[model samples]
Target: MVAMAKKISKTVLSRTDHLLEVRDFVSEAARQFGFSEEDVANIVLAVDEACTNIIKHAYQYAPDKEINIAIVRNNGTFEVKIKDNGKNFNPDALKRPDLQRNLTHHRRGGLGVYLMRKLMDKVEYNFEAGHSNEVSLVKYLSKKQSLIKK
Candidate 1:
């Protein structure tokens, strides 16, 4: 049997206020691809964290910046690509916080990349030739292995 596929794309301003809109759009895309409610919720959460980081850290909540989000479902996998015209970043190099130090300081930041890695089957960052940067998040359907296995 031929696997099914779905694709959707949108661009939204990179502002903290638009984070909820981004989540709603991601949820709708996952729903259309026939993902379970639970899986769809996870996808939305991961994407939300990613966009939140982009808007807050990368773009610094710049109202003029734009974030392009592409949602695709193909070959039994759900994927989301978030492109931003902001400073490039290598999420791979992000250091995990020392839990002890964080607890001592009572810090409430720096968990976005970690959460994205935990929630998605594939988390990748791309620094293009120009100012555009992209973060790709993928989650497989129930039959696929969990991403946490490493």
Candidate 2:
């Protein structure tokens, strides 16, 4: 039998309070997709950061705005796609965070993209100004993990 891709989606208000729910939802899906405990944690954190960015940057702290999170499991890859219909910002335009300077200045924010890149195999962005913004976080199962599955 051929394996088929699986997808699940959830919509939540653009509020920090909803982050826990997003994390829980992503973690559960990642675990079911056969990720290791550590990978599951990484996925959860990445999803949380993505949602938090939408709440803070895109939605501008407007709690009533909507944030959509969708999880897709296909073959040995898992992807989380977050979408928002708010102000669009291009991730490529922002320079990478200066870790050393940030540490010296005791800065607390501005590392979401960097952290997401570190945690996931791929980070991609799609946006149409005044319409919607979407960020996809993808991770692939290790060769060992895939071999163990069969």
Candidate 3:
């Protein structure tokens, strides 16, 4: 028995004020997909970080820009896709943060991508230059989680 994919999407303006809505949207979907509270929290946080990056880097904090967040759940895997038409960026170009150095210098930002990777099972990016930039964050249900949910 294979699980069919279920998808839900929401569009919001590119602004810090909209992040809470994004988090709520993601949290509910993840919960319905049978994720534990801890896993749902991780998914929500990862999705939030992705949206924040889109608003700050891709849209340059332009509040009028549009951000689309879409979630797809299938076969015990949950994936969130965040799309934007602002500037393009290469996630691969980001270097791993030096934790000790950042802590020593009292740095604040530059850790979102790293944190997203840590929270989700997979993090991937698709760039369409001047058209669309999409980041996909994926998490898979462990056997233990699946059994518990059943």
Candidate 4:
């Protein structure tokens, strides 16, 4: 038999104050799915990073727009989709920073994308009708691949 998946979605203003609310949502969702604290933290971190990017680069600090977050868990896997009305980004356009050289020189930027790619099993971006953009991330929970070990 297949397990039932849980789904949750919400929209919040593209403002800094609502970042905490997003974290709370991730925590609650993880708990409902029987995820450990560390697992929950990882999920929250990924979400935070994505949201931070959306706020900083997507909307460019415009308070008039909104961001939508949707989370779904099924068969020991979780998928998160974040949507915004800002400019679209090509995930493939990002280049992995030269950690050896950049780290020594203290170069900034480009780390968020790398971190997101590391934390999530998959990250994808799409532009809808040339007006809205969506970023989706997925993480799987398995005995061998789970972030939380028994």
Off by over 4 Å in 4: 1-5, 99-107, 144-150
Measured against the true structure, the TM-scores of the candidates, in listed sequence, are 0.85, 0.90, 0.90, 0.83
Per-candidate local distance difference test: 0.82, 0.88, 0.89, 0.82
> What's the lDDT for residue 26 in model 4?
78
Reference-based lDDT, residue 55, model 2: 87
Across 1-150, the per-residue lDDT of candidate 3 in tens digits comes to 656348889999999999999999999888877788999999999998999999889989989999999898887889999999989988778888888988999975668999999999999999885779999999999988888778
Cα lDDT tens digits for candidate 4, 2-110: 4545888999998889999999987787766766677678888888888888888888889878999999887778889999999776667768888887879998667
TM-score of 3: 0.90
| lDDT score at residue 73, model 4, on the 0-100 scale | 84
TM-score of 2: 0.90
Best by lDDT: 3
Clashes of each: 0, 0, 0, 0
Give the per-residue lDDT digits (tens) of candidate 1, residues 23-79: 898888777666778888889989998888888778877788899999887756888
Order of quality (TM-score): 3, 2, 1, 4
Model 1 stretches with alpha carbons more than 4 Å out: 1-5, 144-150
